[model samples]
Target chain A: MDADKHFIVGVFDDEEVLLKGIGKIRGNGVKIHDVYSPFPVHGIDDALSIKRSRLPIAAFMFGMTGTALALLMQIWMLGYDWPMIIGGKNHASLPPFIPVTFELTVLLAALGMVGTFFIASDMKPYKWPRQFDLRSTEDKHVMAIDLAINSGKTKDELRSLLRDSGASEVNEKSFE
Target chain B: MQVASSLREALITGGKTVKDVSHDISRHVENKPTKLWWAAMAISVAVMAYGFYCLCYLLWEGVGVWGLNKTVGWAWDITNFVWWVGIGHAGTLISAILLLFRQRWRMSINRAAEAMTIFAVICAATFPFAHMGRLWLGFYWVFPLPNTWGSLWANFNSPLLWDVFAISTYFTVSLVFWYMGLIPDFAVIRDRAVVQGAKIRAQVYNALSFGWQGGAKTWMRYESVALILAGLSTPLVLSVHTIVSMDFATSVIPGWHTTIFPPYFVAGAIFSGFAMVLTLLLITRKVFKLEDYITIYHIELMNIIIIITGSIVGIAYITELFIAWYSGVEYEGYAFYNRVSGPFAWSYWSMMTCNVISPQLFWVKKIRTSLVATFVLSIVVNIGMWFERFVIIVTSLHRDYIPSSWTMFSPTMYDIGEYLFTFGFFFTAFLLFAKFFPVINMAEVKSIVKVASLEKKENASH
Candidate 1:
C-alpha cells in the first residue's frame, strides 16, 4: 500500500478544541497534512503557520495593466487612427477618459484576482476534490495527518495522539 | 469560538447551532418548490411573457412608437433604466461596503441582496438594450470593437459611452462576488445530499460548487479573495452611478447640468436600494420563516440607513433649487420654476412627497420597527424613486429653451408595458433564485452562530 495515500483522520466536534489541538499536535512533533472545516475558523491560518496570500499584489498589477491598455487604446484609436474632435475637446484628453479607465482597472483587478484564486485553490468545474470527511462540509471540523508525512510516528500512535487532542472520533482513510 | 460582546444584541436570535444553520438554510434549496413559490413564479412568467411581447412590438415598430417627440426625446426608457440601476445599488452596498465596515449584521442579508443586485441590473440593462431599436444588428456597436468600417471606434469622450463601460463592469464584478460566496454554501447542500443518499442532488450541487473541498488553505484564500473583491466593488459601485449621473450632468440642459448630480444621484440610489431590500427581505423572512436570522434589529438598522440617505436626497433637491436660483442664468432659473409650477408639476410634487417627505416618517421607532409599515413604506419609496427619475428626465426635456418646440411628454402603452416588462423579469429571476439557491449565507451564519451558541452556554454556566 502507498503510505502517502493513507491518512489518519481525526473528527473534531468544536473549533475551540480543534484550534488548541492543532498547536498541541504540532508541538508533539507530528506534522499535519491539512485541516478541513465547514466554515472558516477565526485563527486557523495562524495556527497552521500559513503565509498571507499575495492576491492583492496580483490585483494591483492587473489593474495597472488595465489602466495602461485603456489609455493606449483610447489615445491610438481617437488621436491617431480615427482623429475626430468631439465637442472640440483635444483628442486623447485625459479628463473624459478617467471614468472608463477607472472602470476597466477595477474590472480587470476583480476578474484577475478571482481567476488566480480558482487556479491556486485548484477549484474548477468537473474537478473532483479529495474530501477527507463528508462532515467537514456540514457541522464538524476535520484534521488529517498523512502517515507518510509523519513517518516518525506509527498509525496507532498518531490515532491515539488525535484522540488525546480532543478529537471525537479517529479513523483511517486511503485514496487509490 | 469568538467572544461575543454583551453590549450589542445578538445579530441572529433564536438559539441556533451550527448544524441547525446548515439544515435550515439548505432545506429550502433541497426540497421541491412550494405551491406559493410555483404560484408566484407562474404570475411572474405570465407578466414577463406579456412584457416580452410588448418589447418585440416596440422593436419592430421602432422608437417612434414610444411617444418620443421633437421636444421630449427621452422619456420612460431612461427613467426606468436609472430607477432599476439605483435599485441595484443596495446589494453591493450590503455585500461589499458593509463587509468592509465589519458589519456582522450584513452576513444574513448580503446573499439575497447581491442576487437582487444581479437581477435588478439585468432589468436595468433591458431599457438601454431595448432603446437601441436595431439591437440585433447593432448591439456590438457600443463596444470598442475594431471593425471593417474604416476601423471606426466608439467615441471615448461621451458620458453615454462611459456608462457603457461602468455598468458592464459593475454587473460582471457583482456577479463574481456573489457566485464566489455561493460556492461554500453549495458545498453545504452537496454534503447534506450525500448523507441523505440523494444522488442527483449531490451530483448537481457538487458540479455547481466546482467540487469544493473546504480545505484550510482554500478557505484562507477564499477569505483573501472576498476581502479584495469587496475593496474593488466599493469604488466600483460608486463609479457606476457617478458615470450614470454624468450622462445627465455633462449635458448643456439647465436642470441636468448641476455639479451636485453625482453625489445626489448616488444618495438617492442607496436610499431607494435599501427600501427595495426591506420590501423584499420582510416578505422573504416571513415566507421562509427566517425571522430569527433576519431579526427586527436588521429592519431597524436598514430603516436608519434609509432615513440618512433619504435626508441626503432631500437636501440635494433643495440644493439644486438653491443653485439653480443663485446661478442667475435665466434658463436655469426657468427650469426650476417649470418643475414646481409647469404642466408636469404633479409628477414633480409626487416625487417631492414620495422621495423627500415619506422616508422621514421612519424617525419614529414605532413606524421604523413595524413590518407592515416597512412594507408599505418600502413600496412607497420605490414609487417615489421612479418618479424622481421621471421628474429629472421628462421635466427637464419637455420644456426646451425654444417655446415653439416645447411639448408635454406622455407614455404610450408600449412605454408602460416595457417598464412592466422589467418588473416581471426582475420578480421572475428573483423568484427562481430564491427557489433554487440558498437564500441565506449558511457558511457565514454558522460561523456567527458559533459565537452566539458559545455565548449562551457561558451565560448558562454563570
Candidate 2:
C-alpha cells in the first residue's frame, strides 16, 4: 500500500511557475491528484482534467423548490387560510406576490449552492485535516501529482521534470 | 532600511515572508499619529452630541418639533430614514455583490463601506424609532407581541411593517457578514501584536476569530460562508430598498403610487451608496496613506458602477415623467407637473442635475480617475438623492387631492437640528469602528496582492 502511495509534489511561488510545472508533469504522463493553493488558481482545473463543478445544477433545483414553496405559501395564505382584503384588492393577486417570490427564490438558491459546495468539498467543522504545506495559505502555490512507486522510474523523472520546469521545491510523500 | 531591502529582495526571490506583511502593516499603525483621524473624530463627536440633544428635545416635546404636518405626515424624518438606508446599500454591494462577481478591487474599499453601512443604518434606525411618539414601545410594531391592554397586531398589509422587517433583516445580515469577513484579518493582527495589553486584546480577538488557522478546510468553509452570505445579501439588499419604496408606493399619494418605485428606489439606493462609498474611500485613502492598495483602478470601477446605477435612476426619472403623463389621471398628472414646475421645482431640478448630470461625467475616464472630481460628484449625488426623497414626500403631500389642505412646508430650526444630529449619530459609530477594527480587509487585500504578483510573473513568462 505504501509503495503504491508515492506522490510527487511540486511547489511554486507564483501561478506562472505552477502552470509551467503542471505542463511538465503532464508531459511526463503523471496523474495529478490535486493542486492546492491559498485561492482558486483559474485554468488549473482544466490542466488537471477535473470535472466541472455541480454547484449551478444544485442552485437551479433549489430555486425551483423556492418558487414552489413561495407559490404554495401565498396560495394557502390568501386563497384559504384567513384571507383578508388588502387595499380592496384580490387576496390571490400576483403583483403583490412578486416581492416575496423574488426574495424566496434568491434565499433558496443561495442556501442550496452553499450546501452543495460544503457536501462536495467534504468540509466540516472541528475535523483533523491533512496539511500539505502551511505557507500555501500565505503565499506559495503547489501542484501535486500521484504516481505508482512500483513504476520504478516515476520519482526521479518527476523530480527532474519539476526542477527543469522551475519548481521552487520538489518533494515526495506517501499516504496510507 | 536594511530590513526593507532584505524584505524587498525576499519578495522578489519568491520568499515573501509573513514578517514582511507584519512589518508593513504594523509600521503604518505605530508610526503615524493619525492627525486626520483625531480631527474627524472630534468633529463627529460634536455632531453626535448635538444630535443626541435634538433627540432628547424631540422625545420630550413630541414629533411636532419637525416640519411635518397633516398633509405631509412623512417629511424629513422618513426622508432621512430612506436616505440613510439608501446610503447603507453600497456597503453590502461592495462586500457581497463584488465578492460574487470575483472582483479583486472590492477588497480595498469593502471594509470602510461595510462600516459605513452599519453606521448609516444606525442613523437610519434612529429616525423611525424616534418618529414613534412613544419611542419606548417600538417593539409593538412587530407582530405576535402580546400586550396587557391589547395585542396590537402589526398590519401585515402595510409596507411600513415590511420596512421594519426588511431593515432589521438587512442590519442583522450585514453585521454578520461584515463580522465574518473581519475575523481572519483580526487573527492576523492578533498573531502580530507586540504589546502585552495588545496581546491580551489580541487573544480576545483571536478567540472571536473562531480559532482561524487559515487551514485549507477553514478557507473552504470561510469562502463558502462568504459566498452564501453574499448571494443572500444581493437580493436581501434589493428587497430592503424595495420595501422602503413600498412604504410610499402602497400609499394613495399620486406621485408616490407607482409600480416603478421598487426598481427606481433600488437603483437610486445603489447609486447613492456607491457615491457615499467613494466619498469615504477618498478621505480614508489619503488619510491612511493607502494609495497603493486602493489604486486608481478601484476608483474607476466604483465610478463605473456609479455611472451605471446613476443612468438607471435617470431612466427611472424619465419613466416616472412619461408614466405620469401617460396615466392621464389629473392628480397624478398635476403631481408630475408640480414636481417639474411647482414651488419645490428647485429641489426636483437639483435631484436631476446631481443624480443624472454629475454621474454622466464618469463616462469620461479622465473625470472618473480624478480624485477631486470624484469627491465633488459623490457629495452632489448624495445631495441630489436626498432631494429625490424630499420631492416625493413634500411635493406630493403639499398639494394632495384636497386643495384646501395645500400648504407650503419648510423645515424649522428643530428640523434642521435633527438633520444635523443624524450626522452626529453616523460619525460616532464610525469613529468607534475606525478605532477598534481594521478599516480594510487585510487578509483579502493580502490575497489580492499575492494574485497580482502571480499575474506579474505570468506576464513576465509570456
Candidate 2 off by > 4 Å: A1-86, A89-176, B1-33, B194-197, B454-462
Off-target runs (Cα >4 Å) in candidate 1 are A1-3, B458-462
Docking class of 2: incorrect
Model 1: per-residue Cα lDDT over A1-176, one tens digit each? 45569999999999999999999999999988899999999799999999988888989999998999889988998999999988988987899888889999999999998999988888887877788899898889999999888888888889889999999999999998
List DockQ for all candidates: 0.85, 0.11
Lowest lDDT 10-mer window, candidate 1 chain B?
B450-459
Encode model 1's per-residue lDDT on B1-462: one tens digit a residue.
Answer: 566697777887788988889888889888888999999999998988889999999889898889888889888999999999999999999999999999999999999999999999999999888888998755457788878888889988989999999999999999999999999999988888998999988889989999998888889999999999999999999999999999999999989988999999999999999999999999889999999899989999999999999999999999999888998999899999999999999998999999888999999999999999999999999999999999999999998888899899899989988988888999999998998899999888888997776666777798
lDDT of 2 by residue, B119-194 (tens): 8898899888888977878787643255764443444556776676678768877887787777666555555552
Candidate 1 Cα deviation (angstroms), residue B330: 1.2
The TM-score leader among the candidates is 1
Interface RMSD of each: 0.9, 6.0
